[model samples]
Target: MKETYEEKINRRLKVKQRIIEVAAGREKADLVIKNATYLNVFSNEFLQGDIAVANGLIAGIGEYEGEKEIDVNGKIVLPGFIDAHIHLESAMVTPSEFAKAVISHGTTTVITDPHEIANVMGLNGIDYMIESTQNLPVDVYFMLPSCVPATAFDESGAGLGYKDIDSYFEHKKVLGLAEMMNYVGVINGDGDVVSKIIASQAHHKKIDGHAPELSGNDLNAYIAAGVYSDHECSTFENALEKLRKGQFIMIREGTAAHNLSALMPLLTKQYSDRCMFATDDKHPSDLLNGGHIDYIVKQALKNGADPIVTLKAATHNAARYFLLNNKGAIAPGYLADIVVADNFADFNVEMVFKRGKLIFDGEVKEFDAPSVDETLVEKCHNTFNLDEVTPNSFKVDGKLGLIGLVGGELLTRNLGFADKTDVENDILKIACVERHKNTNHIGVGYVKGYSLKSGAVATSVAHDSHNIITIGCSDTDIAVAVNAIRKAKGGIAVVENGEVKALLELPVAGLMSEEKLETVNEKLEKAKAEAYRLGADKSIDPFMTLSFLSLPVIPSLRITTKGVFDVEKCELLKDEMSV
Candidate 1:
């Protein structure tokens, strides 16, 4: 029998008394940590004290008695760091797996948008993710996907409107709206966008922002539509302007979108309070090696940021922005979700406690992650529906506009040139195959600076549309890579000379792995190695870099299932162009 909300409330009231008793010294705290130097995010200073925990909440601080005690020897203890915004799907792993990877890195809180999954499996997918993450050491919150298909131009598996997201608005774990990617609709006061915002506001939920490169009045217009936080500011001017306009700046350092270094300089004392740290879409390999939010903090510090300010942005600022009460503070009555780090500069997580229960003990061998619910996987049709694929399908003629790859960022430069076969010049064929409706639609073009001297990479993890996108020097290798992904149902593949070199299968609606985080990382690393062997430069993940060419939301140039897109003008290119 499922317990009602009233029953849960009554049970919580009973625990409330126990917590009060523990705080008053009448009852024993379940556990206590003594001699720890507090991060004290609330006061912006360090304090030395013992923290008392009972009923998964901070019962008291200073001179509290407990049944069990852990000594820290004055190590720095702060609220477990919070990742202000993230897309769990980008980790290419399930929610439980993503939690396992980041919990050890001291990220106790994550605000995620499951729009990618929703685009495939619809509302069922969102529900599956919600059920999948319950009772974990890390606290994962949801920002209901405001734009499932992203825009009208692309064909996604699902098209969610207000009805789809309305129910999740009041869910305690569902914070508010995800990034409102449809800034065009918001600016133009489109009814659909306005109604979605109204639904979130009616429920009093925080709206996350995703306006990349919008400046001045346009940015203000987007903000005025009720997006309170942004993780897509890719430039210093945009980041500062967003902060100036009262939109919380989420400095994102993700797998494809690396905006931290560019925006870190904006972490000035005067504006630091409005800033927060978020890895919008980090891959598992990067998460395992680079160390999640701690890695972001370390990078910000290396970029000459103020230590205290940086730490605040990493923790308190996010908590306050999301209104995660009883979090982001080392004070009485706050959640006893703390991270014991050896030092602030390195941010080496020694131990982590969620609700006073030790989750990560700084020992990898002894760790056990929360079990995932297999039933929560909203099974859908395999996302490979290409009617027929051939080497000839990838051929493009005339003046070609190529998405020029940047070394450390996602923003692409549009390079125009005549189509020709030149391996040295790095003019390679890029295609976005229609996967949703199987309209026999393919957007074929060429891209420069990809550095794929030979072979090809294909992925069904293409952004927003989640189409089958492939890039290759030769049509046969591209076909092989794409065929391998199709055989896997949905996945990423690297092919050379008509043979699959590396493949990572993402069978779950073509976007994420259902396997363990470690497994996904191994597969991704192997694929990345194969990409490098194919002459893909070490500067980027060729698979992911190719995947983003289909995301029309970013800027400059991109492709959708319909055709090649000039994002600035929102124009779709046709069959003819100057060569």
Candidate 2:
């Protein structure tokens, strides 16, 4: 049975009455923390008070009595952290499992783009994510994927134009349009892309950005189209230029791209307000070992940044950016999402409160599991549609255009042309196998800096399209690795001597695992170790680096199911390569 509109109003009125009374100090609060030093984000100062909570909201932040009370005499209480931008699929675990991992580390709210899964399962994938993350300790919000296939050169499982996603703006948790990766579409006035931007603006929603090295009139045209933020800033000069142009910069520090160190100069009183924190993509090991938003905050503080300013960047700045009015503060009428830590130096979390209820006290407490739609689950569980691949599936005919890896960066260099796989020079064969519709259209090419001496590494976690991508010394090993991933439904596989060495299965839409974070991390560690032993690059995460090879939006050159693509020209290589 559902409550009528009138009944719903009455219920809300009753709750509001109690909140007003508690805030006025005429009635007892549901919970209170006494004698605590907390940051006042509004004033940018430290204050002491007895914080009161009632009906899952901060009733008051001054002297007040409560039915239940706890004292934190020396700890610093701050508003919970918010990740401005992230792809939940990058964690390689289910939403519930990802929530548990971050909540304990002080992340209470996250704005995620489901583009990874959306590229593989379409709208059904977005539906699956929303349904499966409900009623959790951490408040998960959605930024509907703005670029499903990302660009024209790639083939994704589905394509979402403005018409496909306009209705989602009305969803309670949906924030705005996600990263507009196709800056070309926006600048050149592509009808479908412009319509999506227009729709987001029509609803007065924030549109995220993904423009790298875009400047001058080209960048102005992009901003004029109404995109609000960007997380791809890898240099201080680039970030400052965008910030000057009125775009909020998200200082991204994730598994593959570490921009925080370079952009630390932005964490000042002059520029900190227009910035926020984001981990665009983080693997399981990085999440469990380093931390989440908490890691970024700690690193900032250690590097001599003002503690209050850093906290504001992690909390209030993001909340205000996404227009989450009731969050990112500790005051009357605000959501009671808070974190208590011993001090700023260590930033060790001692307790966490979500909506006025204690959820983590050194260890995470048990909570109700999220309810997922079984229909969507059934559809997402079986996304692989390719047939068995053979050695012939990976054979390239002539001279190749190689994708050269840039260590610790997502940018790649186009390493001109090569006649053959130069084993001594660390150049090897790379292939992208179309698995979505079983087209059996394999795009074969060569890569320069993978450094894999013998065995091949393969994954179904290819960017945007989630195809089967593998790199190896010989056609036999690449074929073996690709078939192993197909055999596991979808996963990462390593092959040496025509034998599968290690595997980590990601069966959910070939994007994430339903396993616990610990389980996933353990398996990933073993797989990474095997990859390194077989001579993969030690400076970068081999699997994560390989996943980006097919993303045509990045720069210079890329590979797709079609063939080697020149990103600058936006065309498949013809006379440039001996295909």
Evaluated against the true structure, the overall lDDT of model 2 is: 0.91
Compose the digit string of candidate 2's lDDT tens values, residues 458-512: 9999998899888899889999999988878888999899999899999999888
- The Cα error of candidate 2 at residue 384, in Å, is 0.9
Expressed as tens digits, the lDDT of each residue in 1-579 for candidate 1 is: 999999999999999999999998888899999888887776777888889999889988888778999999858888889988888889888777888889889899999898888887778788877887887667899999988788888778889999778988978899999999888889889999878999999998888888888887888788888989888888888788888889888988878878887887778788888989988888888888888988988888788887778888888889898888778888888988888888756768889998888888865323344554565443643555666577877776675566777777777777754366578888777888877776888877777778889899999998887989988889888888877887788999999988898999998888888788888889988999999998988887777787788888877678777667777777775444422
TM-score of each: 0.95, 0.98
The best candidate by TM-score is: 2
* Regions more than 4 Å wrong, model 2: 575-579
- Which 10-residue window in model 1 sums to the lowest lDDT? 363-372
The alpha-carbon lDDT assigned to residue 361 of candidate 2 equals 97
